[model samples]
Target: MEHVRPLPTYLAQRYHGWKATTFAENRAWYKRLADEGQRPRAMVISCCDSRVNVTSIFGADQGEFFIHRNIANLVPPYEPDGNQHGTSAAVEFAVTSLKVAHLIILGHSSCGGVAGCYDMCSGHAPDLEEKSSFVGRWMDLLRPGFERLPAEADETTRRRALEHEAVNVSLENLMTFPFVRSAVENGSLSLHGLWTDIGEGQLYSLGISGEGFAAV
Candidate 1:
């Protein structure tokens, strides 16, 4: 308890504002959600970027999405080594427990995690390449994307390409889970890949057929 700190004045003020505005207007809805338990139709896996606003982008009300955020919106290949796997646990809960109708991998432009992976793979960020770096270890999941990128592309293009590839990689990795694969094959669940341009407010959906990402 000694390490705990009080909320900053700005955040406290914003909480009060939200409580008075959004909470007050949705009081009944909130109470119903609390009483009935959540039955979210979709599970969204996205990056921890502050710029990515899943609720705002989808116009989703509270309790509509089971969302999980990590460094790069990545889903590692299924590993049953009996170790701690946060993403895998979330996926299992969403797929098997919640039985969500859709699972979405939301990637974005200018993602720091993807950029870090690019830099690390390009031999530009030595710190991230260190063995003890947790971030380095996590970003290793994106190495497949880095490998898939064009070798001679310019920095800007390569980074953006890798961002797209990150979504593709996550989608591929999602199928590695038997539960997820079974659900998809039986028409119980569908998978989607989305990429966002934060600055331009544009969104693209990756084709289910592996053709190309199309603006949506």
Candidate 2:
């Protein structure tokens, strides 16, 4: 912690510019949000990929959505073993406390985390195979999704398949939490699965039947 470095000059300059422009334009709105508190309607769980922009994609303003990002956007099954579960904690807060109307699992194409999971599960990543690898363990949540892919497809197709599966897997796991299931059963919450092609700027959403993703 003591070895932490200051922000890069370029990033600091960008921040200053944003503070003087975007932040300045929304000063009153920001102040109002600060005074009134946030009441976001949706909670988006997305990949921690730098290319994926949750707010920009939706054209959302601040305080509009509660966003949580993690590797591959995977969510583990409901576990109350008293361990530190960061993603689960966020989901718990969003569903039980914040009462978000929607919970969306957003996955994207060319996700390195998904790729890593692919490598790890395919017996190609020995480092990740080690028990001490945190990323390896976190990515294990997506293995079921990866395994469901047809063994005949090429690597690219399988990778994309796994990416979409990541979203579905998360949606299913989200329901395992009692609070999330209660919210959905009571009509207070809806679950969504989405995938994005970063380079093509194309977005696809899973159908109501959960068959496959369709262009949106």
Candidate 3:
């Protein structure tokens, strides 16, 4: 790692411009949304990793994508817990309130959370009893992905296998919600699993056939 702190000259300059322009843009868009009561077209479940900015990736302006980001981009099975979950709340708002038509679960390569999934499957996960970080708990949703992989596979291959399979699990979990399932059955909503290769900017979407994923 570089021992020096990188100068934020470019970032500062960019933010200064954005602060002015973004305020102007939001003011107009807010009025439009209020007047027309516009609804978002899609809701995205994305990784909370700083590197993967979903809105920016989609070139979205303000309210284009209803977004929920959490570690590993996980979707827990529908449980009306007495407590509020950030992701769950966003899903509820997007589906029931905002009436988004599409829900996208985006998984990316080189994900630390996914690496944690690989670690969990390999039986080398960090102790959760210590309250290490949100990632520790959030990543637990992916534990099942590990169980789905072959036990005899080598570590490197196993992780790659788990990464792909984890996307499949995330797609399955999306339907566990009553509203999400109902909407799909009623033809009001569509769900998709997408794999993003940040290193190459390639997006692969799981096909309807359920056999192999195809490039988007």
Candidate 4:
């Protein structure tokens, strides 16, 4: 379990094993992304969880979706880090450079980060912040929801509610970006919120409208 299989060889083989016949089918994608300059029509901010692959779920080919994923699918309210607004930077690029028309925040069921926040809220979770750690800071983004969510809710319900709240939080944060805000106000950009349940192979509904969460 120490040193594993030949990763480099396996990766090379896998890349070559793609279902790509003509060079135009595969290599042309990168060329177009670079030259066509990546003018995708949609932007998706999604969870970094490997189980959720944005491109695959959306059935997107190359240059179709501008995606930036993070832990818990979070979008921290806009703060200038001089040059390090990780999520904000991507939002800017998607809005200004790519001119993406849609900004979708995709959340899913069984997110570990949401579970971590829930556990931390219950006082059963240990504080790892005594030492400088990334997970602690990442969980910090969900702190407000953890503190504000009702205590009587069951674990499953709590996680689902957190997913909903987190998406709403990101949508609000999206407005903090100048480009995104203008596009929204100008009616050029639209916001759609989504939740994916991996186990049920189902998608729920929710929106800027009052549809709430219906199965899709």
Off by over 4 Å in 4: 1-7, 19-30, 81-83, 209-211
lDDT of each: 0.95, 0.94, 0.80, 0.79
User: Candidate 4 — what's its lDDT?
Assistant: 0.79
For model 4, the run of ten residues with the poorest summed lDDT: 16-25
Question: How would you encode candidate 1's per-residue C-alpha lDDT over 1-216 as one tens digit per residue?
Answer: 999999999999999999999999999999999999999999999999999989999999999999999999999999999999999999999999999999999999999999999999989999999999999999999998899888788889989999999999999999999999999999999999999999999999999778868999
- TM-score for each candidate, following the candidate numbering: 0.97, 0.97, 0.83, 0.86
Cα lDDT of model 2 by residue, 27-76, tens digit: 99999999999999999999999999999999998999999999999899
lDDT of 4 by residue, 1-216 (tens): 877866698787767666455454678677766886767889988999999988877788877888999888888887786856678888888887778889888889888877777777677677744346577677777777776666798777777788777776777777787777889999999888888998887887575464567776
Model 3 over residues 61-158: C-alpha lDDT tens digits? Answer: 77688888877778887888787777777887898998899999888878887897677545677564236766676777877887878778887777
What is the clash tally of candidate 3?
Answer: 0
Clashes of 4: 0
Superposing every Cα of model 2 onto the true structure, what RMSD results?
1.1
Sort by TM-score, best first: what order? 1, 2, 4, 3
State the displacement of the C-alpha of residue 137, model 4, in Å, after optimal TM-score superposition: 1.1
The predicted structure with the larger TM-score, 1 or 4, is 1
| Candidates ranked, most accurate by lDDT first | 1, 2, 3, 4
Clashes of each: 0, 0, 0, 0
**Which run of 10 residues does model 1 get worst, by summed lDDT?**
205-214
TM-score of 2: 0.97
